[model samples]
Target: MPASVVASAGSSPAARVTIVLPTFNERQNIQPILQQLLALRDRFQLELIVVDDDSADGTADFVKQMAHGEPCLRLIRRVGRSGLSSAIKEGLLDSTGDLAVVMDCDGQHEPAAVAAALDLLIARNADLVIGSRFHPDASIKGLSDKREGGSVLANRLARFTLPRYRQLSDFMSGFFALRLDRCLPMIRQVDSQGFKFLYELLSISRGNLMIEEIPLTFQPRTYGSSKLDISVLWDFGVSIIHTLLLRMVPRRAVSFALVGLSGIGVQLLISNLLILLGFSFVASLPPAVIASACSNYLVNNTLTFRHLRLKGLQLLAGLVKFLVVASLPMLANIGLASVFYARVANDTLFAQIAGIAVVFVWNYAASSRFVWNTP
Candidate 1:
């Protein structure tokens, strides 16, 4: 077994520490990482749990075999549901420990850093301790400039949503430790449907918790491809919108606004595409607006108002209602935007930007109250 040490702590020897590693198709990396974590049992009363989302690559089987030999290692094979946040939540709820640590199974997160995070949690008495890659002493290796740039942009954008977490240089880091009891309450309050849970946790804590950051080098992945994709980025964007508007507006309303934003993007893209295909700009507007509304209704039904979601034939009915709810706003968006463009000196961009803002507020209010207003 590789050398693994527990950070100095004041807790009794009997006090337990659980490390929850969420995995999917991590067959190549699971065994060695488990060996490293299991070694920590010598210093701290430790329990290692692998919460897997039914990886097709034999991740669960590998974990089961390891569990038979090591009494401290446990595996929870999730069958139906998937996602890292939910996997962590399952492990956390089932954890029997004073402190719980969450880390990636991709091997980018150094196994040795776990002890350092625990050290900060013990020494600083922080509610949460993050393993940051952007810290002064941090070094990120093997990531392309584009990927690193995305991380930098995401970290900055997340800060805008929750200023309390602004102190964190790496909010996107999946490695962190917290008191399981303190985290449970906040976890319950957050919608952990998305990729990043730390943002939700800090947003729930509302900038009031005792948080600390520890510098660590982000090592290059030794195996498997990166899971960071456009969908993950979209999830992060939704999380940011949810965090920002959650403080003042109703959840459904915020979701409605977000869905509308995506619809607007779809509309612009389709309209431009039609224009490129030789259709007159004016003739393309109606089809673009209609297409966007239909997509928005489907997205809103499934994601925004998911609790009151419609299906099959009800979708056809919801589409009609969505068009009705969106009709006036569509006309108003165009008229108002055109008026702004005509009045404003040389800024056609400002006109559409301001117009969309106005129409968005109206659509959220009208749609939430009338179209899908299920309590």
Candidate 2:
């Protein structure tokens, strides 16, 4: 956390804001970004927080070398901390602004739009104000139809699936401003996982959602390849599921446990198949355990622990950690089942009851700390 995220945000008192930009590999666009913001600073002298997730293209360095103590402009060089939404969360935590505006660092999300969004937030006392491009008169430029359609589909799905969030044209756009406190608390409940921070925000948007389309062209990024991929798509799908299934932390954990149960079915099926094909009972167990762990990894990585990809290591470490943790439950099950089978010659049900209870705490504690942890 840097002081720019907060220290200078409300320094002016009259019109204080913290504009947070999440950047990833935008070397060629950083200068144009600063120039545009500097121009907008003439209209409003607000603090700026540039949260860069260790771009290999030297984006953070350019900002740091150029923007040294330039009053209201600061850059946070966050290494190992990746993803746009996660970067924004770091910025918000470090921010002290009454209003927080998050945009892109690729010179795409226009700086001038902040004026319109902030005006709406201040006048209407709105909880969230989105810079919509879907409005009829809005000048939406420089994007492919496919890219545009993807957003439309995702946001439409968001509104449909989420009962509380509705009537918003641009639910996926990162360019917007809102009351800092309202949006920040939702982070605790937010998945922050994968790429859709805005979706997570919209998922838990409890107060009024004020959507006003400020007609402005969306310029294409001038540098670096887009981070959107199959993983992003997978995460988007899981985000909706998580939002619909569980909207709170406790509810989310319970839902994950439910999903874990389904994983057990697949694991057992695979293990039994391997055993039927001439594998040892112990050998079959690894296949089943590994299969279940893999399934859990896919779902949890894409849905639960996505935002914490601060480092690539966290992903691999979490999986290895999962295997280590899963061993406890596996041993517990085997030991209980062996004793019961040997003594009563029956009562498999009794063993299952004891085994499940023991594993519950082991899985919960390990997953909470190593898997879907927020802080």
Candidate 3:
């Protein structure tokens, strides 16, 4: 709202654009991207918000130092926080611009494309304008064959969740521009934990927004290494599932349920192996149950409740707490199944399934609150 920030080169009224750059540890790449973006100030009123997740390499501090002289430049140093989508969310929400552009700070996303994307957003009166790497006219020399293939597969899966915007070539693209006022409602519903904020926005909008795509020329990063890892893939898969489930189920619940299914597999495998080894059914059951519970606890700690993941002494203490909280449910499972099997029906499978369902609900609820301290 400063007079200087609103001033544009031309007489035509300029839309104040907030260019949000989400960074982790891009100290090597930040300066160049910032300079390129700032160069566009003559054409458009621009506000550059660098959302840094407390990078160990002091990416935030560098941005802070740079912001001292530049009135349009600002830095949001997020301590004890991470994730690209969340950072983008925070940046967009904090923006005072009429339009917002979210892009990578690592230099893979072309800074020049910001102007084109914003222009298209205004020209087409679109709520969202995506800078798509997979657009037919778009050039992608940045991603390797493997990464491209993975992106292709992810976009395909993402399309299934987005029936209306299925034609979008790059749902996984990081660079995008949006009319902030139009997207504000849907943006609030977007899951910050998602790996792709565009996908989250598209899915949450439920085809209400007028969307368009602009060709993006993605180049390889010059300084920093790629953030692509197994954990990112895992988060992407979770995001897809979160969309497919109609956002009715909490993402953590889905992960918890999957972990529970794995626990069931462990229990069955162990129990069957024990039976083959001449152990009695009753004798094998306890060890198998205990083994499955331990497996579930460990996996839930690692993936289901990863944000509040236990470590070292905390791990041992959490395991103890998990077992204690799980005991009542474990007992109820056995008790309910026995009652149903003995009194109501002789169907062992039906009784066991009913018990498993109870155990899953109880364990997930109890473990979330007690074991992980998550609500």
lDDT of each: 0.78, 0.68, 0.84
Q: What root-mean-square deviation over C-alphas does model 2 reach? A: 6.0
What digit string (tens of lDDT, one per residue) describes model 2 on residues 287-354? 56567767876666664555554247766777777778777776776666556655765654454445
Each prediction's total of clashing residue pairs, residues at least 3 apart in sequence or on different chains, is 0, 4, 0
Which pairs in model 3 have colliding backbones? none
Put down candidate 3 lDDT per residue, 1-375, tens digits, no spaces. 335333442435477889999999999999988999998787777899999989999898899999998999999998766788889999999999888999998888988898888778777777889999889999998999999998899989998889998778999889999888888888887878777898888888888888899998899988979988766777787888888899899888887887888888887788769979999655665677778899999988877666678999999999999989988887776677667867898764566566778888888888889888878
Model 3: what TM-score?
0.91
* lDDT of candidate model 2 versus the reference: 0.68
- Runs in model 3 with CA error above 4 Å? 1-13, 336-354
Worst 10 residues of 3 by lDDT: 2-11
List TM-score per model, in order.
0.74, 0.74, 0.91
Which whole-number lDDT from 0 to 100 does residue 139 have in model 2? Answer: 65
| Candidate 2 backbone collisions, by pair | 5-95, 6-96, 80-310, 193-307
Runs of candidate 2 exceeding 4 Å displacement:
1-14, 123-125, 181-191, 209-211, 249-269, 275-286, 294-321, 331-361, 367-375
TM-score of 1: 0.74
